[model samples]
Target chain A: MAQTSTLDRGGATPSAPARRPTAPRRSRGLPAWAVPYALLLPGLLVIGGLLLYPLYQMVEMSFYKVGLRQIRPNPRPAEFLGAGNYTEVFRSELFWSSLRNTVVFAAVTVALTLLAGTLVGLLLHRLGRAMSTFVVVGIMAAWATPPTATAVIWKWLFDADAGVVNWALGLLPGPLSELIFGTSDWSGRPWLNSPATIYLVLVVAVVWASFPFIAVSVLAGLKSIPSELYEAARVDGSGPVTTFWKITFPLLRPVFSVLLVLSVIWDFKVFTQLYVLAGGTTNREAFNLSLWAYTEAFSAPPKMGFGAAIAVVLTLILLVITGVYVRQIVRTEDVR
Target chain B: MEHVSRVLTRGIAGHSVWRYLLNSAVVALGTVLAGSVVALLAATAVARFRFRFRTTFLILLLIVQMIPAEALLIPLFLMVRRLGLYDQLLGLVVVNVGFTLPFAIWMLRTFVAAVPKELEEAAAIDGAGRLVTFWRVLFPLVAPGLVATSIFSFITAWNEFVFALTLINDQGGYTMPVALGFFTSQRSTDWGGIMAASTLMTIPVIVFFLLVQRRMVSGLVAGAVKG
Candidate 1:
């Protein structure tokens, strides 16, 4: 009764009802159904206008043969050709190489990030509080860095002439350097000179940039597990690896699932770092799906329609692969 | 780090790094403010009130998170140009806010829900108005979550490259990340300049992360775990 009276207190007290939170007023205000929608209007407008509408436009453009001339205020009109762009893309060697590179890059980076993250997460769980906080903060500094900056740092650190990485390699004996890298000198060995080596630096930079988030997330997941489970495993004399697989792995399934899907999406579409490392669209052979799409759309003599087609295909591929995870996330949200 | 500061201070391509930093600040701060306001209102509505299609709204947010910014670049370019915001910092701000809104709302919803419902009632019982109650009681409690979400939005805008690269064409309009691209080219190399500028770009992000990282852990987990 008291709650109802206060909630229903009329608009008579103008000052006190400053923001009469369109709260539950079964008596005679706006319908309850309208409130959430009203509040959500701004967000809905932005998403609908910016995200959904553009996506629709992207899909529409994919069916046409539009380019720089077509996109101009006054120019040649675009011609709709159901799948001509897709056919051209499939036939192009550039597309195949980008697809192959993207797949390989995503596969390797996801695996390394998960493995390293989980192990670090476990280490964080086992460590004393101060030490764990110290290590987690240290790694997060890397994750917090902008992607372009990370690429530049790694590129400079691996510079052929005056880089610290090569300088460190020089400190090793000639025979050791030869045995390890199949080379006697690190000088003038361009990390960015070829597709294979650019990916090496790229993989290192991305993994270093990405793993900290996974590790922190895994740490958060680890903290949620009851120590009793670990204690029980210890009493059962289970080995470290055994305990990990039998106990920890089962406990962190959800976190791992979420991380796996997110990492795949992130790595598959990785653009900035790769763009910086490859030194722009200059190196066509090293493009990933995202970069290839960008270069196609915005590069010289922009093939806007063709670029839209690539983006659509990439989205489709991502949808097919990650559709389950997306559904899972939606399902989790449905619980409320 | 020293080299990075030197390059940034000396300027790049005859353009002052400070100018680019100011542009980035405008976009990032604008995103944080605009994204947070809309997200907070929506989050409060979702968390505190029962409404039709609530589940659908939440689900839509998750789907939006999955869509890559690159996929929407083509039409967005047209949209921005048509809106007469082309080559403007405000355009970048709006797009960043749109991209970051779903995330900010989702993360903040959990924090909003964490605030005790009883407190709001207590404040109202004291003859406080709805807005007053929220400001005096709710805002202080939810500030951590707000800070966390705002930081994420800020970083998203600050480091965004693809949209910044595509939307603005003028050399003077460059954001820091896009500006870094100018130092490298096909025929020439400027390792010192690139390294110096890159390090300067990274410092602010790290500083901000350190400030709210503790909340971010819980904030991240909350978004993932909560329905």
Candidate 2:
């Protein structure tokens, strides 16, 4: 939000640089931009060293044949295989299936989380201060918990034989049990084995993990709307739903769009839940691209180059998602 | 409540819960303490100064936020191993601090900047030193920001699975995430036990957020709106 206002303010300042003493002075020895650039150097260096270089190495490794053989003391001659790794990835059924699963997982998770988050946000907003504090705290707790621990907890809850979910389901009256389990035997089905089941479980876990941020973001947007707008709507004899449709929803669109794009990008890269849920080995078809790439890199003799290729592909997808998010945020800001 | 309690207690033994709690606390506390110090100093410098590269530094911090932690796993692991930090809690703390510093600085900078500069200037005109002005005049105003960012840093560090899995090998030294992984085996995963452990693990984070949520909300709105 400040990005738009800050740019406008930044433009106006250059016209009257002489008026404000606090304004940055251009020294004779150094160029005007040098001060700001110099302040930025340490941060730039750290990011370049820590983030950019590794990214570069990943791209390079994707094209070269480097693995256990390359780890040897003398090292074998590494050859540029061009897009051989990418070609091999495209040809592999595991890669295609995982990519498909990843898209489905991300899309479904974003949809579910957005639905849950928006409802909760509106609930808390309507409830005003009554249940707001308690609900907010509960949501934030889910948001803050470590993913590994959360994954473990959900895994147990969904356990076939001894899990609370199945135990609770069994408590339901009559032939519903027979319908769920088939016959009176009534044991729960293995959830992680089937692609459909695993996909559903992953979606639920990811939604639970991510929804709080959306709720809070929406809540923030809700707070920004002047109360006078609602008061004016009420004076016109508008019902609650109509008032929300006409006034609240339109104002929240910018924030909602931003949250949706962020959730999509975040959900696509999810690894911990799927990786843990599958117990490190399941239908490779059920895996997302992140886990698939990880297994490729570190399982057995290790296909580092191939893994790097998958990682590169995943990175490109993330970049595309990010580009869309930035463009939408910029465009919406311009409209305002 | 009774049914929930029964479900929680059914399969979990006492010793494992205690062990898991201990491990989680150690990792979480170490990460928060180390991360806060780095974030505080860095945020203070960037917020208060008008140095040449300040804008560049801020932009760089934003870009760093975009790089996923997964991408840095291998390089960080290698760096830690080289430093003889592998398998140690200290190593985990170091890495968590490094990972959280950019966010901490970015978030904290907004709160620090929001403190009226006039207050600090008044203190300075009265012949107060920079350190005194910061400690007496500025710190109190920014305390909420510190709490919010510290909670964020703690959550990120505590919840992290990838780096913990990569760096630590000894079960005793393992953080909660890696320990959770050990619940699964070739034969069958101990679903009940895993769930109970996970539920237990989530409790502290829940409590921590509950303690800080009000402050966190204000802090987030202030930071984002200001930025």
Candidate 3:
């Protein structure tokens, strides 16, 4: 969001110098144009060698047969398989299950996270300054907790025998608990056992860890709207729901779109929390694409090429989804 | 309360958490320093200079940011092994820097752009050399942004789980997140130990986040929304 409007207001005095083609680059024995290149070289080298090059290598590896032996210290060359791994992945039921798990988990988690986050954001906006700060700090504690830590905390809380969740549930009246959970005895009921339940825990943990960011972002967007619009709506006897839908939602569309896309991308890439909750990829039923890829590539008797294919597929799906956002960013940059 | 302290102590002593803490600190600090310098230079270039491929570079950063880091794990693992950085803390530092650079550069560009060109020109006219002017005028002006970006890098590197989990095979090399991961995966799960270790790992990030929450919320939203 490098809006030059802000910059123009801040530096209105000497803005002309910024646009000059021959701006002062008297930074020693370097040519003017070479200065920028020199400044960019180290960053380019790191991103090129690590990010871009590895992306290329991943695509390349997807078409090969790579394993632990081929990746050893004194490595043997990987045999080229020419899309064999992709075909095999397509043929496997595990791949389809993992894909389903990934998509379903992302869909549920994104919806819940946004809904909770937007409500919290609205509350924060309505509160007094000190109250908002107090609430925000509490939320930040949740938001800033590492994913590993979040999973661990949630896992312990939902432990079969000693978990606070089951204990609290058991304290509820029998018929009410049964009505809600289909049983009064949540005692010793394992929340992380099946694919469905593991995803349930994963959703709670992820939504807890993620919603703060969305809340903060939404709050910021809400703060940017002019209060006069709300006052006028109130004068017209608009209900809170009507006002929000008509004014707030339309005004914050850009922020909402960005947050929606980011949440999808993040939920799609959920790895650490799932890995921990599903107990290190042992539970095949709970495996999302990330866990599936890691298990295939890094576990014993590793099929690195097969894993690469899964990862490539995941990347392509993400790229296609986020391509519009990237184009929008580029257009915004052009505007600036 | 007393039992909690004892459990926390046992968790720390039993798992060699001090070692992991030291590892996380080293990796996070390294990432902050290296990521800041590299990102600052690039941000300055993008903000100040109208260079060729400038728009392309900006677009590339966006695209790179969109790709999940987990997807690159397979090839990066091989590349790290080939580069002889496998299983090393420095390797994690390098990876974290690579991951954090794009956002850091994007955030810092606004800061650099906000600093008026006139101040630098005045410094130059007053016989301040390029390096001198940058250090004196530009760097101080961008220090708040630097702090924000550094904190971001610190949190990212400190909390990084996937890369640390796959890359480091040795127990001694395990960072805090990886170390906490072991408590969950073990057959006889120690809930107290896990909770204590999780608290230990989470405290620093929460503290840092509270210290800068006001600036960070606006900065993050502005950076994301405006871009």
**Candidate 1 residue-wise lDDT, A107-137, digit = tens:** 9999999988888888888899999989988
Computed on C-alpha atoms, the DockQ of candidate 2 is 0.23
Interface CA RMSD, all predictions: 3.7, 7.5, 5.6
* Docking verdict class for candidate 3: medium
Lowest summed lDDT window (length 10), candidate 1 chain B: B183-192
DockQ-based class of model 2: acceptable
* DockQ for candidate 3, C-alpha atoms: 0.53
Candidate 1 deviant stretches above 4 angstroms: A1-29, A175-184, A330-334, B1-5, B124-129, B186-189, B225-227
Each prediction's whole-model lDDT (CA): 0.82, 0.70, 0.84
All candidates: TM-score: 0.92, 0.82, 0.92
For all candidates listed, what's the TM-score of chain B alone? Answer: 0.94, 0.87, 0.93
Tens digit of per-residue lDDT, candidate 2, span A60-178: 88897767676455677767899999999999998888888989888888999999988888888877685887788777777777777666666667778766776776677648766
Candidate 1 chain A has its poorest 10 consecutive residues by lDDT at A22-31
Candidate 3 local lDDT, A1-336, one digit each (tens) = 121233334433463554332223342357656878999999899889879999999999999999988988778898999989999999999999999999999999999999999999999999999999999889977988899999988888888887999899778678886677787655788898999989999999999999998988888889889999999999999999999999999988777877888889889989999998888878998888888998999989999999999999999999987887876665545513
lDDT of 2 by residue, B1-227 (tens): 44335434442332344555566577777877866665666677777665655555665565556556665564565467667888988888766766777877777877887898878765544434445666899888988889888987777777877778777877777666666676554224545455555666677777777778887766654443221
Off-target runs (Cα >4 Å) in candidate 2 are A1-46, A72-79, A128-130, A168-186, A327-336, B1-27, B49-59, B82-84, B129-132, B186-192, B221-227
